[model samples]
Target: MKESLYKRIARELAQQISTGTYPPGSLFPTEMELCEIWQVSRHTMREALRELTEQGLISRRKGAGTRVCEPPTSGVNHPLSHLEDLLLLAKNNLRVIKKIDEIVADIELSQLIDCPPGSRWLHIASIREDAQNPDAPICWTDSYASTDYARLRTFIRDDPHSLISDLIETHYGIKSHEVHQTITAVGVPKKIAKILNVEPDSPGMRIVRRYRDRDGKVFETTISIHPAGRYTCSIVLKSQNSGE
Candidate 1:
């Protein structure tokens, strides 16, 4: 089967991005330029750009031209990968400005946080705003921490700029030497859809992160979901030795 022209265009542009021909944080060609270069109609060019945007590769503004976004990381490179990193790569570019704390021990959550049944756990709920549009929320994150790290609460409140792991290590001397991540696709629940401004049952990606300290104890676990249209995760592989 032959692929559509729009798909071909999108794939070519994506290859450029992955190869660094169109480096991150750079401006993409104008729509008119794309139309001219591809010899396609304006509508087809727009569709190609939309595909790129939905894949989280580029951002377009009314005044500013489309801009390439930063590459997405697995949160493994840094002890604490801030939400900002993902948001910057998000199509909507949401910002998390406030964090609220609570305590919960729901049956399912207890297991996820690695605490015993009925064990007390710290919870942090945050609302993130689209960087390009402040009025809308791109997504929401609810995080849980073990009771032993309760004293680290103030660290999160005082320094919202730091990654959660960094805050934990800085305040309680618990370092996350290992991290486990799992990703899955799910339909948006009604409550989450309301918060994310998407229709109920919309497609979304759920990412679960478990952070383990130097002693191999689980300190923190977070579950975050983003609307499918809002984010993209890509990986590039390079061969170390070729043509042997």
Candidate 2:
């Protein structure tokens, strides 16, 4: 079947973005201009732009025309509606390590990471930042890795884009069968607030992700705190019988 006109236009716009023809933060052509260029109706152009917005590729505002934006990991707009978007988050941000230490999980730590109290863990503190804007950190993260993967510290220090669970799978053959995630609204702690360039006790979102192996063992857990206004999470819901 032939692709719909709006879908074709959306694909063309995405390609233009990927090729840097329309760079991030650059203003996209107005709806009228786009309609004229493609010789399509206003409704067709609107749908085309809507498709790009849903893909996290552009932002639209009443006074702001349309603006090309970076993928979710850059914090312009984060769409958690699909697995691919989660992978994109890991691919786009670079995690810069600040410190690493081996310690036994105490009661508080165990509850925080959802691990056993007595289990040994390698605590890795890092700050993730957008590759394009490294000076302004995106979030402060605390990662806890199973002691079995202690060598991950060295590898993680050397590489920034690779997730620890992925590295564990690559080096130790421990595949991640599932991931448990939780999101909470919290305040930015004073200790890491300065690093994240946010004030202490400011509104923030704390995201906790735990990667579990086939046997349901948690191998890696990361808690990330993103300041408000720096991140926006968009969830898309589809109808079960939307085929019609």
Each prediction's number of clashing residue pairs = 1, 0
Top-TM-score candidate index = 2
User: What local lDDT score does residue 26 receive in model 1, on the 0 to 100 scale?
Assistant: 95
After superposition, candidate 1 runs with Cα above 4 Å error: 1-101, 236-244
Model 1 weakest lDDT span, ten residues long: 74-83
Give residue 69's error in model 1 in angstroms: 8.1
TM-score, cand. 2 vs. native: 0.71
Q: lDDT value for candidate 1? A: 0.66
Q: In model 2, what lDDT does residue 197 have?
A: 85
Error in Å for residue 156 of model 1: 2.6
Best by lDDT: 2
- Report, for every candidate in turn, its global Cα lDDT versus the true structure: 0.66, 0.80
